[model samples]
Target: DRGPVPVEEGQEVDVTVDSVGRRGDGIARFNNFVIFVPGTNAGDKVKVRITSVRNNFATGEVVKGE
Candidate 1:
């Protein structure tokens, strides 16, 4: 039931920062795809550039993770 959503890598995504990771990265989910965004704080709304993509998840380098 879970899989990649055909989003290209390095794409920009605007997401609401849901939580904070152990390394201080922002956690957000989109369309059943989980994205780990680095350099952002929780409760922030920012645009992130997708950096890494896996089957069920992806990683984003904060364009606004600051």
Candidate 2:
């Protein structure tokens, strides 16, 4: 189940892709909180819209860039 949310649904944010996850999604962080972004790669700088949030991680989609 989802826990405390750091970001709201549809919240847009700019982040740098730090690493790639096991499923090929890009991993970014904010305040040390993890955000998993699909269709992204390591070292990519992009803007994303938060789609879902959980206790330890969140998921978003790339709104701009690779």
Candidate 3:
């Protein structure tokens, strides 16, 4: 069972990196929802564009320093 996805494709949002996942991606939250972003680390703040959205989580790319 899953809830409605809070984000849509190409949506840009800002989040604070909370931790690193097993694949070395930075994990952050939007409204307590999880998003994984590569090339980021814990304590890093960034803006991301949503690339994919799944049932429980989403994937995004860092668009910072742009």
Candidate 4:
């Protein structure tokens, strides 16, 4: 079951790169939360460090290499 989460802003998380966006960011998911990672592409395994959190989406940076 889905429980309440207490993830803070700017929190780092690990996720798999799923696909790329038109703006060139990478799409990843962590704990069922979707995040957009900059400087990354599709099909790349990466670790994303959260940069911003919104109501429905999140933004992050790649902690690992491309």
The TM-scores, one per candidate, come to 0.80, 0.86, 0.91, 0.77
For model 4, residues 2-65, the per-residue Cα lDDT tens digits are 4544345767776788898889888887777678888887778776777887766689877776
Rank list by lDDT: 3, 2, 1, 4
The local lDDT score (0 to 100) that residue 21 gets in candidate 4 is 84
Global CA lDDT of candidate 1, please?
0.79
Q: Pairs clashing in candidate 1?
A: 39-65
lDDT of 1 by residue, 1-66 (tens): 564475669799888889998888778887757898887777888888888888877898767643
Candidate 4 colliding pairs, count: 0
Worst 10 residues of 3 by lDDT: 1-10
* lDDT agreement with native, every candidate: 0.79, 0.88, 0.91, 0.75
lDDT tens digits by residue: candidate 2, 1-66:
444666878999999999998999999996677999998889999998999987888899988885
Q: Which ranges of candidate 1 are over 4 A from the true structure?
A: none
Which stretches of model 3 miss by more than 4 angstroms?
none
Candidate 2 stretches with Cα past 4 Å from truth are: 1-4
Tens digit per residue, CA lDDT, model 3, 1-66: 546788988999999989999999999999878999999999999999999988889999999923
